[model samples]
Target: MFRNGYKMKPIIATLAGLMLIVALACAGESATPTSKPTNTPAPVATATSAPAATVPAGATATEVPVPAEGPELTSMETYMQSSGYMPEWGEPKTGGIFKWRVSRNNSNFSPNMSGTTHGLFNMPRYGSLIRFDPWVGFTSIIPDLAKSWAWNDDMTTLTFQLYEGVKFQNIPEVPESYNGGKVRGDEFTCEDVGPSAERHVRPPKWETTLKKGQRSLWHLTGVTCPDGPLGYTAEVHFEVPLGKTMSALAQGLMVMLDKDWLEWYNTEHPAGMTKGTNEAYHLGMGTGPYIPGEFKSDIVGEHRRNPDYHRDGLPLADGIDVVILKDFTTAFTALATGQIHVMGRGSWSMTPAQVAQAQRDFPDRITVHPNAHLFGYGVGFNVGRAPYDNPKVRQAVQLAMDRDEWLLLRDAGELPGGMKMLALVSGTPWSYSVEELEQMRGIRDKLTPGGQEDVAEANALLDEVFGEGNRELEISCMAAGVEYVEDCLLFADMMKKNLGIKVVMESVEPAVGTDRSKTGAYEMNSGAVAASTDFGDPDDYLLPKISTRYNANSSAVLRNLEALKVNEPELMLWLEDTIDKQSRELDFVKRHAMVRELENKIYYDLALYIPFGQRMAFPGTGPAVKGYRLFDLSLYSNWSIWERVWLDE
Candidate 1:
């Protein structure tokens, strides 16, 4: 049986360093790994130094044969071993604030209601059952709230043995009901499990409550917490292989909310010093390293260390203060002047030039982590819309998208991280090798002769599809944030110049961007997705991203898929089935093969999203900012890292 349990575990702003830009040498590295919590737990991750693991940043993979039987790898030993990604940020110190920056702020603090940007700014306040290790090889796992877990003989029923005496934060100032008169609620017990498992982010039936749970499709049938909210153990039952259940639990999307907190939130009673702040934050709490402090919807949000936290020796810093810098240039200035201790530790907070500048100008004042990060970002097409609905049209647009040009235009084609392949594989064990990508059409080096041939083919496809007169049509494009708006402009220019499509670009608020994307309200939009953000499961990202199901395809987030389904029924069914098969396959090697038939590749064939402006997080950190790294590409999970970081100053 394939049953196992294991634990583990941007932004450019400046153009200050000309010489450093030319020679982006390795900063430094160590292998100490993340600090372990005596109380809290770990997450779902990649296999070990085991062969198929580690798809080098800009290199190809070395294939290994799969074993026919025996036991598959579990997460138990994944965290101890380092993938040589650790940074020697000095000994851990205590008591200082981690001042970080974001392009925007989050409003709705609810799990299912929030967007990616929300995680970027406030994820540290949330804790999951399992969390991505804050140290190296984020693709692997460790424990978080879950003390340990196990699957049955067929790998269907999963159970979690909870850590005892884990108490929820007690901010008497924030509650929605007339219960618990201004005191810490109760210990996180078994009763919290039933409501969490019964209601989640995934879709079909449960989706009605949480419409966008990591984008559609699930295998969980029921969850039975026998002892209710008072006990510790929780039993969950699934209809198929334990897929969505694992990712959802580990990703923090489905958290074990305090039973009383849920009651107050559901009943709608109010408490707290400030009504708005309480509603957005304290109303729902968790067993995390930090507590939500003073919050300004757009300007800033403060996270205070949880003194009564369940985890011991955690939250090395006293707190985290996340502020917003409208654009990359402004954010870089903040980092340079030490206005913020770290920028973009969670999201693409800065630019490549700024990273080089920070290290060059403030060599001792700042610490630049030159390694770790693979961003899958670009422009997503709404396939449910006409013209975009046509596969040939989609393919043509993708063919014309010059990934190399995007790099040049966006980051001057020079990144300290080097030229990295994004999207499709996203630096995962199951990702296509650089060698294989070189042979593909939409990907591959755009400066080469083969690339020119691909462009010629794209023009031919466009000619065949649009004829001549209607070639120049108009389309609306949108994106959120200053960086994304810039990305939108570059993509719009490329599409107009190459595909003869006139584009209108708009930079909307972050919330608007998500709602529009979720509803397919635009023709194209700036996009990025961390396939491993939720969990290292293909089902976590793929199904909702590319599925033909109405409102399921997040890349398109189209309203009606009836047109695409009618036109390509076989392809749609196969894509859906393949996604399902991969989710069910527990063996690493076999599942890798199924993830990509690799012949046509879904990203290229479906052409719903064309990845351009690829990025490797170039986060700039002040000297005092130590023990910090992106929890995941999209900054959606691993908020637990806050527990490991300490402000050296």
Candidate 2:
């Protein structure tokens, strides 16, 4: 999100001649800081005295009541009437450079090695097997790379036919022995995909593992490349039924790489060679709208439009220039000054005052897009640790603070109702139950009953768990120096006020906080895990929070893991099965019930980490910009689509 602040100042002119010169200099150009007053007008009220003696002179005159005028129509209605869906149209005039400010600089360009943060930019530049069409609510696997595919009834065996006309970006400057010269597009076949999958699945080379002992894992059993009726096809067989397998394949996996390029680079650099890093970072290629042009650590990474891209009409921008500014203030300043066009990755965090100023100043010049992310922000306790190790103590902590109070204090006014607790948002299925949520109120009542912190109840619970007069039980909280930290502090203060248990707050750098959480260094952490968008399976939430094997990085409860494993196979297989709607829904509800039942055992944190409100914002642009929809996913990738954008005269 974009935000700016305005300082209130009184204007006084010392010299009229100098002021006049300043005014003339500013004319016909963008407003400068000293040009105009930023404050708005206040309301004024007028008083009227009643006529006394005048009535005597006009005794026969009668008073008439004037009819009230109805409220005027808003400007939005006027615009809608003036223009249909083709608002101010001709065709969408396209062609201009759209600049964006990214919060971090990414060094990893290799799609195979790029993690989620880097992948956001790379995905659009590099095509995927399947694509998400939000409007259609389904997945599309374009035959640009994969010609076609066949799936078995059991969904265990899947075959993909490869397209002939495809080639990686070619660098003519490089020697022929380097295999940097262009290869015929038709030479690309099914043989390429199998090896890529094999490479991904292979041992210590890549971190992703497919093991048999794990029933719920995303384990691929076999992958084969064979000649087929359509030329050649790659067959992939999974150990278990995965309904999201196709979606995953379309989303991330199956990005085809030139086998020759990979082989040559590997041979030239060998393993662990420093020169290999340069080849991987700079010369690596893909068949996307954009190609990696240059990368410098902690500085800048540039992506240039691909001239040989296979797509019919694509890659709107000439190039994308991404600069990493770890300092948010600098990034925000750059955005306000129009130095950058976009904010890459993560939601924008802004003060309420800054948000108000941006709305007032930019108005139509900026756009704000609010997305529902999967992660939650709340207090998570280590169930194995002291105090929280006891279920009653956990319940007491849940009851101590009203979530509404915390929302008001931390979010300024935003509520958590809009936030998604489980994988799905509030309106969707698998969200929290109304009755169960109301139970929280009852829990609060049990603590204080008077809408205040109940010190007696907290102390009693703590004393019962750790014996009376033992206020020395240590509970460590991990917090960042943000609103989230304030929320944690609020909770901590309430715990002390109501329960007599002293809680310590440990504020750390965001990166350090993440590392600590991953290493299980804190007794309680304030954050959440993000689930996949457009996918609403309960397993996404349940497994990650409770599965010991899957969430080995977390210090989740062991009993929760054991209980989850009881119906693990049933839930896993049922999730992917192509069954009737009724049957599918029933299984989903059953799985949810099992997880909810285990949740009562104090398996996870009492307060499910939910967002108070969306923190990210996109500012609007001027009339010169067109064909851009705020809050909508770019037809291609977030970073790549900027090229297609063009400026209007």
Candidate 3:
């Protein structure tokens, strides 16, 4: 049986130099070993000795295998032991300006915004009540603004005790800049925390726009502020029972802002303060470790370490400079040439050739870390449309394309089994069983022979749905100008060759894909869905993609929306009962069966979005860079302990 309780250990070794392979491999499955030399010379480093740590008996100590025998092999553990860079039981070195090349500038910085741009910036600089430590690989709730929290009997209401020393960076009346200025005020109190929570629950202007021109908080239900020592104890009530609410709140939602600064920023920059405007550039008042210093729209954003940062001793870096390189090629070049120390979100841009070249050229300078969560990129067919409205047509399309072939064509390396349908959730707690997957394959086999190059089968299904005519099907997809547009064209070409179905490609803005998919405007929208870090439940996989509430806007594409809406209550109840009664292993099996039923109904036919075989890449310096870990890919990744990292140089 696969152990669900497996936790990752902190990477403790520092290689003088290391070669990292950053291929776009298939999701969920381990990569096939390539014929590469393992005993390459280590990069020269200032520190040459490693630390010693005992490996517990019976604990797994699997060494990464070297492919070809060339030079004597030195284990990464032994390398760290020989080098004095191993992490000791104390805070890491913390002072240096680390420059990172980012692909895009943030559109908004508010934690409440649902976009990826906002989500990325909000998590690192801002302090969460609880945070994930990638080094130790555990979730820890820290005493930042909130000192302590307790749960109710039903796990519904969570009351938090606020810390007194916490203070927002720039309140107008106090006039203390983030640099060396001093603010004449008591440490942040319940007055700040209470109102902030209350506002999220019931904003004064429910539909009002923010200073950044973004939408207001209208989705929240209620927030009750604290009264006494207890002044910090605020009660939050939910509309429905949510198990991950605390985690979500701790992740970023509960980030506190100073009331004075909020009011001043709004007054000083009335027009700029709206949700979509670039007003956040002028306003930086969070109690985070870093204070926003400079902002160049779509070019760069600089943040200086906060001198008054509430964390006892954190944010080891002197400053963080984020340079936005919208082009992947430019970012990759920067990483290869040592123009930047780190690169964020470079996975989608790396090709097979680039991965090989990086390993060859800058073998010792870079380290690549794969994120554990599912990041799916697939095609979504609008089921409300005519041709796809037919279940047989959808099934025929699934049968026509070989997932393995598509992976090879796409240059994606390896993927977990059953990844063709559910690209991201292939091997986790939510992965489907092999038996159930085989049953799905049987359904596909009945429609096509060998499930590859079945032109007649595809044509037969297309003709059955649209009738025997020269009338072509219009499958609207994003233009090739977008990143994954080629994948859409690949799907189109396969369908035309095998099924004799001529699909007219419609290209539009990337946002149009999201709009069309949500509104069911297009017959099919080839897009991708990235899983949030806190996601563990299968509902996280299914709800936004297919739930009635989420799909209401795209109701046009859902032929059976009305029927599904009626059955939603029962489905939700079934999901809850399944969760309560079975173990996680059985729960995944049951969930897989349930989602398979939905897939059969053809609400949306799954297409290869992630293009299995592509591996995500996170490039960073070796262990000499303090606070650096292989898993520091995102906010949820190991970089959360920024204060713990220090420069050895």
Task: Rank candidates, TM-score, best first.
Answer: 1, 3, 2
lDDT string for model 3 (574-649, tens) is: 5334433321222223434554454343322333122322224434453345545433123332334444455654
Q: Which sequence of candidate numbers ranks them by lDDT, best first?
A: 1, 3, 2
**Highest TM-score, which number?**
1
Count the clashes in each prediction.
36, 24, 51
TM-score of each prediction: 0.75, 0.67, 0.68
Q: How many backbone clashes does candidate 1 have?
A: 36
Models, CA RMSD each:
9.7, 16.1, 11.6
Model 2 CA lDDT for position 17: 35
lDDT score of model 3? 0.44
- Write down the TM-score for model 2: 0.67
